[model samples]
Target: MNHDNLLAPYAARSAASRGRKHEEPYKDSRPVFERDRDRIIHCAAFRRLEYKTQVFVNHEGDYYRTRLTHSLEVAQIGRGIARRLHLNEDLVEALALAHDLGHTPFGHTGEVVLNRLMADHGGFEHNRQSLRIVELLEERYPGFDGLNLAWETREGIIKHSSQYDHPGHPEDDDFEPHQRPTLEAQIIDLADEIAYNNHDIDDGLKAGYITLDELAALEIWQDMSALVSRKYPHLRGERQAYQTISHLIGHLIDDLVQTTTENLKAYHIDNLEAVRSHPDYLVRLSGETARKNKQLKAFLYRQLYRHYKVERMRIKAERFVTLLFTSYKENPTLLPRKLQQRFDEHGKERVICDYIAGMTDRSALDEYKRLYEPYERV
Candidate 1:
């Protein structure tokens, strides 16, 4: 089927893509963005996400979401929204799946520490790191140093924004920092918020860091909880919590689609060019929904993210990242021979930052023990 034919006029079409950095002959029937998605899925960075942190460390519990599962959820939500809006599902899915490819081992804490450590050396941010991963880090292709993803996919990865992400960087000058990314990329941003906001609630409740009574105080949660109760009176316990979260996610998606459709009309965005030329995001939730979502986020920030236990982990993660980066900086020989070879080309700090940033939570911990522990095996 010609999937492009079904996409809205404003959606990003693979045929119109700016193309990859290192050109290759078309070797398959898959569209350009689809090929980018497949490449991301097979990359080492994506595989490492399986062991990377979301809100909890990998070993915290078997039930909590990891970066891999979070990315999957974001992709699922992004594709659903794209389908409803008649946008390019492939492009949205690509952006969603590859959004967090550059996250450090211990979630935001790791990123924070790394940024602090590299404050003099251009600083560190996941969005830029993600861009680097696709453009120059992952060495899968014999012809290129990185994945050589489609320009749209690379733009989405760099421009991906959320409360946690600050996307602009000096190295991203090639991506037109002044312009808005495609609507597909914009969709990934919100889809990412929806995934983490809702899933974090589930993880927080499961971990006993936040309770239902506290959540009931938030208007968004109360509204969803009431709806879930009315719809499924027999639901109780964790099942009820799950149902409420499910309903909340559905409500958010529905509101986003409706509001974004209204925005497209309001802003006169009828084509891909219009989307990019627009002054602000064409994809967004309604004002009321945004306010409610903000409230929910604030609640999570105070109740879940700031919980004593999570803070303790954050502190430890900071220490681990700081120590690791410092050790690698002081003793460049400690890095694997492969990483050491890149020191001449990429500089020592950046090469070390890249190596440490790519670590999974467990691997970072294991590496720390091997380097510092007297009896631990290297």
Candidate 2:
């Protein structure tokens, strides 16, 4: 697995990879991170992402961004950023692809209900569940219970700082919370933000939940609008909207690259050691872009995320997850035979939680109907 790489001095080199939790023979063609990426892609949990929620549920629409597409978008942006900065593209790609593997079917709504249900066991967070997935849930290889991913990949999953994920929580206790993750891992967070924000804009527009005229009120929207107009004067309607999003993504990446490069210089961080030991995170957007991005986020929160339609989905998601948990808790026999066998080892509630968390949105709904309708297919 020792492949020659032209990584930045501060980049995470594959040769220096902290070995997996379980030892295994290495492959010759693909490097460690590449294998990690392939392993994630082949896992059952990763495939379930197609039906997992991002903003809209699976049955909501065909075109809306699902968890699968969102993960792909994050990887696309992360790889572009990684390449530009001479960072580890393979690790960045792996982190981006694997980051959302632990997300529940109904998105944050599912996570909230699981947290409430498992309050006495251990609170549920997608990030921790993600690590749990790669560490012990995915029973792929004969010798290992989980993927036994490289330690750096696992650390990135644990500490993937995002708008939804804040650091210093008890969950981060497993690692050195004081030190920063690799430069590549650090990029995943910002890349996630960049992907979700812009894609949300697109999905909201396509769904008619948000209008172009409404977006005019936001400064970032106006900035992009002007650029799109000038760059392609004849472009109109949906095409204009699409191009504006493309332009915005480009601009954000430009800002992030520029800002991260400047931070590297400002901190005099010459190597991976310096990046880890730095007191604060050094990869970031410039001040101006940060403010603009925040404004856009606020607009999405108020206008799109908190809008009546999205809230309605969130409410139903809560109920579905809650009822499912309750039913399983009352009658453990209701769970599939395989999961029932896990109860003795992991506890009934934890086993049930894992079973439910692993379900796709469509399958969860199907399970509900099968359980409640009586006449529905078993």
Candidate 3:
């Protein structure tokens, strides 16, 4: 079936996509956004997300969410919202999956170290790095360096923002940075928060970073826990925690859908033009949900993220990234031959940052050992 036939006027229909940077023939059956989604899923950078950390380090545990799983969860949530609103699910899914393509291994700590290291050389930001990946990094097509994604998907990735992410892609002048992105792109921002917050709660509890008694004090957790207990009276322990988290995700999705619908009506957004011209995001939480979410984030910051154990891992990750960047900067020959050639075009600091940003957690660690350890195999 032709998917483009179903998009609403306000939706980003594939037939009308801004198209790729380098023009290519379209596969007749698949919509452009669907092709974009397929291309992203098949890219090498997408696969490396598995070894990249979300909260805990890659070596911390098998159960903690990796960037890959987090991306999938964001896509699932984004699609749910898109379907509910008759928006473009394919575009939402593509944005969701591709948003984290440029994330460094070992989570935000790695980003911090790399940013400081590159301060003299244009600086580093994951959102910009993500755009760089799609526009320049991934070498899939012989004709193009990056994935050559549609302009909309690239904009969505650049606009990916949340409590932690401060989105900006100054180099992406093709898309209007001053205005809001499509509502489908906006959904990924909320989906990222909903996915990470609830999943982190599970991981935190399992890691014994936070306790049930302590969680009981939080408003959102308590509200969901009561619902889980009422619905599954016999469920307890890990099963209960799972059920509660499941309900909480549903709760957040419900709030986002309802509130976003209200905002759409309030703003008089009729088509894609209105969404772009709007000054602020049209998709967001209700006042009540936003207030409660603030409490939830504040609690996580003081209780889980700032916990001494998590800080220890952060320190280690920062050290790994700093040392690795410094070594490569001192001697550019250490990079792979192909990357060494790019140093003339991309420059030493940027080429090194690209190489480091592209590495998976274990790959970064292994590289560290190879360079610093006398006995480690190169």
TM agreement with the true structure for every prediction: 0.98, 0.97, 0.97
Q: What are the runs in model 3 whose C-alpha is more than 4 Å off?
A: none
Better of 1 and 2 by lDDT: 1
Per-residue CA lDDT of model 1 for 164-205, tens digit only, reads: 888667878998999999999999989999999999999999
Instruction: Find the 10 residues in a row with the least total lDDT in model 2.
Output: 1-10
Q: Whole-model lDDT, candidate 3?
A: 0.88
Clashing pairs in 3: none
Query: Clashing residue pairs, candidate 2?
Result: none
Look at candidate 2 and tell me the lDDT of residue 30. Answer: 72
Residue-level lDDT of model 2, residues 1-378, one tens digit each, is 333357778888878887777877765657778889999999999999999999999998999999999999999999999999999999999999999998988988898889889999987888888888998999879787999888898899998978786456676776778889999999999999999999999999988889999988888888998999998999999999998899999999999999999999998999999999999898899998899899999999899998899999899888888889999999888887998998889889898888889989999999889888989988
44 Cα displacement, candidate 2 (Å):
0.7
Reference-based lDDT, each prediction: 0.92, 0.90, 0.88
Off by over 4 Å in 1: none
Cα lDDT for residue 24, candidate 2 = 77
Q: Which lDDT tens digits does candidate 3 get at residues 1-378?
A: 767567666778887888888977654768778888998999988999999998888788899999999999999999999999889999999999998888998888888888888888888889899888888888878777888888888888888887767665457576787878888899999999999898999999999999889989988889999999898899889999989889989999999999988888898888999988988898888898888888988888899999999999888888899888888888878889998988889898999998999999999999999999999989
